[model samples]
Target: MSADLVLDGLDKRFPGSPTPALRGFSLTVAAGTCTAVLGPSGSGKSTLLRVIAGLEEPDAGEVRIDGTDVAGVAAEHRGVGMVFQRSLLFPHLTILDNVAFSDRVSGMNRRAARSRAGEYLEMVQLQGFGDRRVGELSGGQEQRVAIARALAAEPAVLLLDEPFSALDPALRSDMHDLLDSVRQAVSPTIVLVTHDRDEAARASDRIALLEHGVLLHEGTVLDAYRRPQNVRASQIMGGRNAVPGVVRDGSHHSALGAVPVPLDTPTGSGTLVIRQEDVAVLDGGVGPADTGSIAGVVESVRVTGARSEIAVRCGDALLHAEAPPTQRCQLGDRIRLMLPTTAVHIVAD
Candidate 1:
């Protein structure tokens, strides 16, 4: 059965390091919920996952699953399954045997273990590849088998550590959909570690931002994107256009103009993080701008087959706006940029 996962004051440090990899990390994940842990490299995203899986021991803090502390439990006995970036399947073992390894290790009869493994393989859409050697499958197929292997253990918590990192862009999307399907098939408490923001936004029920080995922010994907806790969190969460602004209780004053955001703050200096996709480029034909419009000269335009990314220079600040390929935007043309009140995030840190 699935269980809620909790961590409190989790601190882990490698010997000789000046700072801890995980510092005072705490989180509560509801049962059968998928929480994506997001962070840049060396930010303890993987370390936190390892600690929860009992692969790494925290110097201090407690890891509780369903309100029971499991800090002293061995890795295999923790009832957690991990799918690493690379599928470390045994070369000599067939796909079925590799998937069933967990069951066999748990002392199940060979026939029963094989049957259970077959079920997981079918769930992962690898129904007939059971007898194929692990060396013969493609990378994406191997990852599917690995996921099946992890689930075959019947783990209460599934931890995926960048499971789709090796797959190509197209395959990555497919794998994402596959993960969503798996979640629907068997709702287990899942913790996924990823650097891909779009993937996290699409798959995660909640996105937890981690930075410099610290848990920076935790919220719904849209909330974290709309109102990031800090500047660092904003950058990682796809705040491409970072604008320096001053908060004036009701609105923010930027190079463009004083635009109202969906937040109230004490009158102080702050920065605004605007998402490129959220900033709509208005052509005279698209629509008429309302009150919160700032005019800018188009600096450059980049076309990527189906879509165009236009860079506009408004005073000292440059805004990157995503436009359609058919939109006739040219360099040196004066364009009006409108940042929706809800799209402009006032982050004061």
Candidate 2:
């Protein structure tokens, strides 16, 4: 059965570090759901995972699995499987032997453990490669073998700490697909720690954001983008344009001009954040200019995949706008930019 993982009011600090690695950190990963603890380096992302895995002790609070406190539990008895960035597979073992190592150590006989490991290897699509040595496997294959090994243990919870950060972009994507498929088979409660937002979005059912040892936001990925908890959350999750403004009579007055806002918005100084994709640049087409439209001069354009990120200078505020790749835009081109009122999410400065 899958276990629900919970951490409540967790705090941790190193001997000489000025800031605590985790401060009043609290979260709950629902049974069988993948929750990515997303944050940048030194943000306590790995520390949080370590505490839950029983590798590190917390200064305060408790770590619980299925309502039982596990603060004093040994790492091996926590019923958790961990896949680090590297494979860390034993050099002397075959792929099958490596996968079956944990099971055998836990008292399963060699035959039974290998049988179980073989099932998981096939699940990762490495059916016939079981006899191959770890040195002969590709990086992606090694990571897949590592994942297969973790799942083979049949742990109640699985912890993946930047497991694909070393893989190339293409291979990383393949691993992501493999993980997505593998989860449906065993369905372990997973906590995926990643610095990449795309990885977090693609791999998990929900997201828990941490920054400077603080638990800033927790919610579904869509809601996080639609309505960020604060200015930093808005900026971090794709809202790159944060414009300084003040609330006046249910509207934000800024360099771009008055933009309508909710009546209950704090009536004072604030910042309005908008996604670059939401900013529509008019070419005497798309959204034509009127008093409601704001105009800016195109400063630069860079194509990224199917869209072009165009920088527009509107007075003192320079904003980024994403346009279709086919749209013709030139530097120094004066264009009108249309920002729908709904696209503007007000956040504290």
Candidate of highest TM-score = 2
- Candidate 1: 10-residue stretch with minimal lDDT: 281-290
For residue 140, what is the lDDT in candidate 2? 97
Model 2 ranges off by over 4 Å: 262-268, 285-288
Clashing pairs in 1: none
- Evaluate model 1: give its lDDT: 0.88
lDDT of 2 by residue, 1-349 (tens): 4799999999999899999999999999999999998887999999998999999999999999988999899999988889999999998999999999998898999999999889999999999999999999999999999999988888889999999999999999999999888888878899999999889999899988899989888999876675677777776676778888898887898987888876667888888888888887876732556655787888999998999999999888888999898887889888888787777778766
Indicate the TM-score of model 1: 0.93
TM per prediction: 0.93, 0.94
Counting clashing residue pairs in each candidate, in order, gives: 0, 0
lDDT of 2: 0.88
Instruction: Give the clash count for model 2.
Output: 0
RMSD to the hidden true structure, all candidates: 2.3, 2.0
Please give the range of 10 consecutive residues that has the lowest summed lDDT in model 2.
Answer: 283-292
